[model samples]
Target: MKRLVITLMLIFSSIIFSQSNYEILPIKQHLNDIYIIRMLEGENIGLYSIIDSKGNLLTQTDNILISVQKNHIYLVTKDYKEGLMTTDGKWIAKIGEYNFKEKYSNMYKEAENNSEKEFFIVYINEMPRHKYGYINYKGELQIPIIYDEAENFSEGLAAVKLNNKWGYIDTEGNVKIGFNFDEAYDFKNDLALVRIDDTSFYIDKNGQKKLMKSLFREGKEKIENLGYHIGSAFEGKLKIKEKTN
Candidate 1:
């Protein structure tokens, strides 16, 4: 009886031990190779320099925090916000915070023809009405922030909401695409996925809807969440999952 109890306890302990899980993803800077890192335990996660494919933690655990693009986990942020930070720890932008929505919709103006326009979030001191505009990446309010909301730039265009309508605008702040569309998404690759009424369609870089789904750029591939989503197209492969007996 004593032997049976001890055996069961040992088996349970072994099962728990084997279930302990962690993930390591590869990192890179442009064509330069960085280190692989992962977020573990709590809010604090740093990119460790251990190069073993098995994710060994080495001496330089102070490098990068990762975001998986494909199988390669690119360094996107190191801050607790886990927002984007340069190697020198500068705030470039926060991922997933670029979208602008209201009680109505997520819309914007089109990019101006043959012009350079940028996306911006207009900060207002009071409620509603035209106010100061701020640009993303490029820090110049070329266009006044007269609109209620605005979003980031993709494929040289952004979506802005004004007078309770949506329109597309070039980075130059010109109304290349008028205030239209009930809702829209930032461009990925070369197409922006948009939803108007009850229909969803893919728009080209020029903001023209592509009726043929095949002609449309394939949907942006989601990196494996098990390991991490690396930046850029996946070069390395990682299978992040639990081992089943």
Candidate 2:
């Protein structure tokens, strides 16, 4: 049991970014390079790269930004504006209308798996009204650009905010579970951990609580079958105690 748990943990860590029904977001720069984000604990945008570039890394931005397909780097201004530059310090995609006065932005520091013949750097747009969304490898809005907040993909589902509440959404941008929780976690064993009224519980992708079926459906049947007398608790516990029909 311990070994099984350890294996699952390792798999989860490996594909933490491969969100949704085990969907793998395949992105690579070239034949032998794998684009990956290696952010160490404590740093905001730590070590974004295409594996080992043989010291030919394209380091161009101050705040985690990269476009492997275009081979460009972007820097955001102190007041939340984007500035684009190349790996060797050349202006390619300049920051202007879209970046000016933008409240939310999603920045990509490096590609994933380094196989992306095409890629994009996202801006969170963190604005309450904007709530920036994600883009596909083709730079298309796979998910609607509208959301209060969006999390990384996990198990083909993502935590999205709508109407000031949170819920889960499939890759098609359809709501799977009702968005009415104070907090939510990734899916595990086909169940998602949700918090309600100071209590934490697990619910299936369909929003059914795991223990609900057993507690409500089976608890009563089991009680009746036992003749409504749960005497097992006292059985053999006391020296003089005896059980009767």
Taking the tens digit of each residue's C-alpha lDDT, what string does model 1 give over 44-75? 34333333433333223443444322112223
Q: How close is candidate 2 to the true structure, as a TM-score?
A: 0.43
lDDT: worst 10-residue window of model 1: 102-111
Q: Estimate each model's TM-score.
A: 0.38, 0.43
Off by over 4 Å in 2: 1-130, 212-245
In angstroms, the error of model 1 at 154 is: 1.4
Q: For model 1, what is the C-alpha lDDT against the true structure?
A: 0.48
